[model samples]
Target: MEPARLGSHLVVHLNRLKENFEALKKRYKENNILFMVKADGYGHGIIEIVKYAFNDLGVREFGVATLGEAITLRRHLSSLPFEIYVFSDLQFFQPELSELYLEYRLIPVISHNDDLDVVLNNPKFSNLPLCLKFNTGMNRLGLSLEKSEEIIKSLKAVNRCKIFHLMSHLANASMPMSTNKRNIGQKEKFKELKEQFISAGIELERTSLANSGALEQESCKEETHIRPGLMLFGATSMAPQHVDKSWWQGKIISELKTKVLNVFDVSKGDPLGYGSTPCPQAGTVAIIALGYGDGISTRFMGATLYHKGVAGKVCARVCMDMTYVLFPKGTDIKRGENFWIWDGDSKMFMELARETKTLPYELVIQLTTRVPRIYQID
Candidate 1:
């Protein structure tokens, strides 16, 4: 393992990423899987992940959030035949950039009526597929069901409009499909649109609504394609005790490690940094070299830093440049010894997410570029 170019950095376990992908494949069972490579592969170097998926994992399709991500991907692997779907890019509708779409084989997932109009009104875009997106219940991207009906009515005249794919998103799939009202409603709405497509004689090449969390819901299995994002980067976000039959707790592939910058004894009544909270007991307090500047926040006060598998309680509120951890007096930790701000343990990561009151997605993408990512292949 090469040393990280920085004092604190992420060790991205590419092999574990492969494991997670395999797990998702087994769960999905032969369905077309579209890896969500957007947000810089969820802040895990995008190009490396894409190449590994294409050349090593045999994945042929990916979904990104912008033309810039797709364009940058195309520039690197120009000759590869893998597909890149831009989920929310208005740039693809621009006539000036339209050529790049064909050149790069970029498929734009259109959600708005006007964007769809841009494609329908132009002859150049006629040859491209209609990768339509509808806002079933996410209320995010995609058109409303009523608006979608209006557009599907208009598409009847455009014979060249290949209804290649239909896509939507779920707002709260973390709950059970049987009890989650929003999930049930969204699935029904999406199915209604699919039925409409069939009735209108519009053939869809694929359909997707399942993101990382939704993969657990059986309702999503009916769709032809699955778009998993956070899980691919090794974040299941499921609590250990709550994991059930449908749990897709993939292997964590990223580990955030930071070195101990300083170590000193603190009296039982002595105050720790940035807070009036006294040290619980006389112990050795270590100052970790990483903090909020590296994406860790004061909210992680509840996180326990682990060095050599020994847990140390957070002694004070996290600072921008450092965090204080109180270890037992005789603990074998020392300055320069790396502590797992978070290692590749999914449970530890979940605990930190719980402490920070953030989604696992936020934790990964929040990492600043200043914290270098070091790939761990084996």
Candidate 2:
């Protein structure tokens, strides 16, 4: 069946995801891969990414930022042999959440000592498998070194629920310069915990400590499992200082395209709409129906968009639902022609990030529900 048309009309390239996973798998063949699909797979559509990652890439484990996200993913995937881990540490929803976890066979990350307490006492987690998250230096979630060792001892005395993997998150993996310090520190911390797990008789069968940034860092590959999020989406913050063009070898997995709504010529003296912003030199102006509300940054007002091999500068103030661009003199532009806002062929997103002073992660998330996303197969 042909997929239904999207209301907002954005396209997600599935082939790029498959290629990225293939590349990563080739690079780290020894490690188990847990595809991180949190934040809607970093705003790339979780279900679609999951399908490609699992069906095409052979990924059997997934990571989510919240219990809600895990539940949603489970509902969409019926009986796939996948391990769904919730990265969040919240335990308040234990009752309802535990029921769902049991129902869907989801793996919950136990962060604090209180987490085990809540689970052991909760009726739903009586016999379910739980993944313990150890916080080496993040100081965010997971049990501390001292606390974790103590909990490991306590679990030996009780009906130790099934344990999936011993895991920790890397804070400095993305910054290649900090790899020595941050990676070393985390390795030492996890090493201590690994010993404790052995002493406590927990096999620590499946272990993971790497995110996207750690994939490139040799020190992070120490763990048997690697959880990658950004790299699988073909977006990387691993930009070198000199900006090597070869670094962008991976294909862009997401592209935002919009059609020109109207085109007209404006004189140099004429002030453009809103804020009475100064108009460009006498030239053709094209209005596009994509704006901040649709994820285009307001700082992109002066940013450039390429259409039919010609570049146009976004002019005037960008409204909530629309923006205007001025094409060079005599440059023919027609209505209904597609405009490339951000695509594989251009550095529009990189420019937008610089102009808005925002990270690529933020820029993508801002693309709210107003813009529809269509998943395209390779």
Candidate 3:
């Protein structure tokens, strides 16, 4: 079925996503790549991204934040043999949920001790595969290094449950220096815990510690697996100083576009928008069918929007469904012409992120579902 077109839409380039994945693959040739597809593939539409990554690129592992996301993906790709890791702690682990995980063959990342106990003690999940996360530095989730011995002992006692992987997160891998102290420290801690378990005769099949930022560092390059989310979607994980933009070669995957709804000739000192900010001089104002309601940040005021190789500044405060763009006198722009809010230009997107005081990831994910998503392989 053909989807209805909207005034404002996000065009996703699946080819660019594949290019980004290939770039990462070249850099981490020996490691398992667990593409992170949480937050609906960072708001790029998870189902399509998964199909392209799995069927076309041979990505066999995925990481999502919640059980619901995993379940949705599982239902969509029921026939494919792939592993989905749930990153959230098991606060809601129950007999029924355990059975579902077993039936679906989902791997749960046990972060807290209590959650580990529940999973190990649950009879339904006795033979289920599990991943143990350690709190090396992120301190957000995962068991502490001090509890490594206890966790090892617990896992050793488990008769049916099997340990699939050991994982930790690097907190500051995106810092300026490649050899960040915190990143190094976290890697060391994780290594120590891994060794302790191995020496105790517990076979940890795989270990993952690198995120998108850590993938660039030599310290994190040797992990058995690397879980990348933003980079896979063609967005940078850190500031430019920390990550070389040239190395990424990641094209912007989403293009945000809208049409000029109307054009108005404003006189000097004329009040504009909700704030009634007066225009400094006579100029042409182009009203676009997009605003904060569509995830266009109010901070985007004074930013540039491009049309036919010409750029104009947002003149007034953004409204819920409309925004005003100011152009020079005698400009040839007409009503109903397409204007690019974000044109899949890397430099422009970076500037937008800077103007909004947020990361590229935040900007893309903030795109509300009100705007339709159109997928294009080319």
TM-score of each: 0.92, 0.88, 0.93
- Per-residue accuracy of model 1 over 34-113 as CA lDDT, tens digit each: 99998898988898889889988988998899989999988988777899999887584567886677777888888888
C-alpha lDDT (0 to 100) for residue 161 of candidate 1: 36
What's the lDDT for candidate 3? 0.81
Q: Which lDDT tens digits does candidate 3 get at residues 1-378? A: 445355788889889888888888888889889989888889988888888888999999998898888889999989889899889934354656756677778888888888788888767767677788989889898898888877777777875334688899878867632456886688788888878877888777888998877664434666788998887777676767756622665678999888889998989889997879887678899999988899887888878777776777888899999998888876878998887888788878877787777788887788889888888887
The number of the candidate with the highest TM-score is: 3
- All predictions: root-mean-square deviation over Cα? 2.4, 3.0, 2.2
Go through the candidates in order and give the clash count of each. Answer: 0, 1, 0
Candidate with best lDDT: 1
**For candidate 1, what is the TM-score?**
0.92
lDDT of each: 0.81, 0.74, 0.81
Off by over 4 Å in 2: 1-8, 89-94, 121-126, 159-162, 177-180, 239-248, 267-269, 280-282, 346-348
Positional deviation of 366 in candidate 1, in angstroms? 1.3
Which ranges of candidate 1 are over 4 A from the true structure?
1-6, 92-100, 238-242, 274-281
Per-residue lDDT value at 22 in model 2: 79
